[model samples]
Target chain A: MSGLRITTAAEGTTHRVVLTGELDHETAPELERTLARLPQAAGHRLVIDLSGLALCDSSGLTTFIVARERALAAGTGFELTAPPPPVSRMLRVTGLDRVLLARHPQDA
Target chain B: MSVAGHQVEEPEDREASFSALLEDSMEDLYDNAPCGYLSTLLDGEIAKVNATLLTWLGYRREDLVGRRSFADLLSVGGKLYHETHYAPMLRMHGEARELALDLVTADGHRLPVLVTATVKKNQDGDPLLVRITVFDARERRAYERELLRARREAERERERLQRLTSTLQRTLLPAELPEVLGLEIAAHYHAASSDQVGGDFYDVFPLDADRWGFFLGDVCGKGPQAAVLTSLTRYTLRAAAVHDTDPVAVLSTLNSVLRQRHDPGAPRFCTVVFGLLQPDGDDFAVSLASGGHPPPLVIRADGEVDVLTTPGGQLVGALPDAHFVATSARLTPGDVLVLYTDGLTEARRADGLMLGEDEERLPALAAGFAGTGARAVVDSLAEVLTAWADEPSDDTAILALGPRPPEAR
Candidate 1:
């Protein structure tokens, strides 16, 4: 029932986690646990595809930061692709997108 | 010799008694006056001060009569404030006028007080000594502090309430829009002012792989009552969609839910637009249901923006089984559909101009953003509103969903 999903792109080590649903106090911890499990990609990248995100709150923003930090410490690069515009703008203002790789266009 | 002696003695005795009475009255008046009484020498030395001020400060006269100057009884900051602010004013004025100050107590506490000093003059009209009066301001200071504390507490509570309301408000909307293949979703909610709560809401969710359910509504009021109705409307829409894909039936059920429980006498009302978004292999088909709400704005893949012309939707809960209007449209990749609350259209500028309703002005942003895609369109849409609503908006909310461009695939 958790809105978070983790799957490695089949051919590459690029771990792509697609986040769906609302991230609030109730569900943000679920993401923290999920992000902690992925393989340590020393040189590879982690892309969080947020195309499915409907609403983002403080808990959601914090979870992304935690995910980005974990990726950073692991020597893995963190990227967030396809953030819904509202979430994307919030990240921009909070300067989170600068830490995580953020591509505004959600499609590709 | 005896007569002269007796007469002289009587006058002397009379003079002595009268002088004694005069001295006693002076002491009594100085010690018990409503205001504090003190005299300082030219060098700022306390020569004599009354018992009234001593009592106000919980001090003994012996402690200050000759041992301490007036400045010794001031707090560190109060001392500095007096030196820099009060002293100059007092000196320049010859009588330091009513100056609010704090005098330290013997017990190491503070006394809020006001003091006024006047320079006494001799017969020659030369400055002789300074006499000061101290009035206890404990009651006034206490009252002012209490008022400040209450204001600060209320502000903190409002901020907490805004957060709580925002948290609850966010829950009322979809957490994440269901990712329909080849679709980009954009949403914005413009909080009016955090001072008070609002009833504006919007949402989009997945109904099926090829279809999605979305709506935007404005509840008529505020506070706990409106919040409860908002929750009911949101959950009912989500659950009712599962039971019926038809927008009208879903609204009908919502009307019944509102009618059954909520008091119509309280006059609760809401404007809502429910839509089922279906995508064909290459094109998208949308069916919309309206219940006394604003029409949805559609930006076509071809860069044309226009209001979807669905009208005559009845207010939900106003009447039992109120009729709702339904409409449809075809969507190609790059089509943007935006549903919003009246707050967006009704946003007023300081100049008193309002951003026209979606049906009128949405196309300006949509047309300009034709090639840029849904995210860009929504960004512009939100930006236009921000610029237009420089003043606080009542309760603006928007839900935008569009098909992804070929590159997004």
Candidate 2:
């Protein structure tokens, strides 16, 4: 079986999606569908929790960029939370850390 | 005679014993074979399962037979795939072979297995049941994962190298061309491919208060080795220009440096055009030195395009003592001077002719925008380069300089 799973939850005005397993070219479409289904109303906060994510590739990075654009167009707040060391390193190396807002779960 | 008669009398009893032994062995083999076996009804309901299959899945024969479907034993993703893809394929083709999937055990642990299924047909040729054989794939799955990890690591390593190459390539050129008062200057660098760093480089910097040093060059090859030579050449040219405003002297110093640094066995050489520019009244006095490099094109204020001829020049660092020639040109207020690497002339067109090989091609190209300023000329050339049907196979670098109009200045 492909090693990827996603779960969503709601808290007040914020919608949280927790991702697990490897996120690569093979499974990026599944994540894209999940992001597309998210509520895009103004004042909505969407927080993607990545603590359980094991891996990501260029496709995953592109998906995050698209999600950020969607949230901006709808006037919603978007952020990534609790990315593992490898994911954070990838973001830093690609210079995406400055563009994508990331915070710890406790901080969020 | 009595013993022989007794042996003949027991033959019928012995034949019956042998037939019973063969039947017992066949049943045992079916139940205890190495691979698991199962027969499912058309709707995937478990009709018959061998003891081996039941043991592998940690389930009793009663738990599966007539109760569970084959899809029910799969993980969530496996079940989805089976319903969406494999099931439809099986229905159409009447068989599915070597499908890799995971089976969920009674304890919720997944057992990686490879399955091959064939549809059984009755006498009327209608589907009766599906027979599937399952093989344990734990070792194969582990090996595949290792291979995938190695591939991912290699990709990441290549990405890192590209980043380093791009950053290093940037340092080899000036961050921003120095602002020269009364002179409009523009430059462009076109890389053939991003996988390897190209050795084409250009720089426009101030040598002193009145004079400026500018150059465009292409090394023999590309990547780390050529990049090292490019960096060294850029520094050497700038230093040499400071000591002497003579373009020929600057290139001669560079030629000597290249010859001394690299070994004779693996000689490194470059084609370069070094220039020194100084404001002379209403115009700029330009002295360009060639090291087997293409000559610069000058578009006069009156719309006359001319290519300066610098003869008897040899490639830099090619020999112990290489000669260089300095040519002079004057850039009037509306006139522009353009220097380019060989990549431009060598760029191939669809018809197999080079952009600058013919004598009339470059002059005609410049004539089209004869009165344009430095920036406009550079921008136009860049647009032309990008409009080609195919990308240039080599790196190209261009530098254009013109005196600003009196009113604009």
lDDT for each residue of candidate 2 in B138-239, tens digit (9 for 90 to 100): 999999999999999999999998898889889998899888878898898888877788889899888878988899988766788889889989999999
Write the residue-wise lDDT of candidate 1 on A4-92 in tens digits: 45444523767888878766556777777777777866886788888887656545655665566567768987888888765664444
Provide the lowest-lDDT 10-residue window in model 2 chain A: A90-99
Best by TM-score: 2
Q: Tens digit of lDDT per residue, candidate 1, span B1-409? A: 2775574457878898888777467778889888888888766678898888888888888888877877888889878987897768766777787777889898989998888888888998778878888999999899989999999999999889888877877777667766667778888777775654568777788886566888889776666767787888989988999999999998888888887864422545577888898877766788988886767777877778767754446767655546777888877787888787767665667764556523346557657777566677767878888888776547778777777767768
lDDT of 2 by residue, A13-57 (tens): 789999999787678778888988988889999898889987775
Candidate 2 residue spans exceeding 4 A from truth? A1-108, B1-29
DockQ (CA atoms), all models? 0.01, 0.01
The residue pairs in collision within model 2 are none
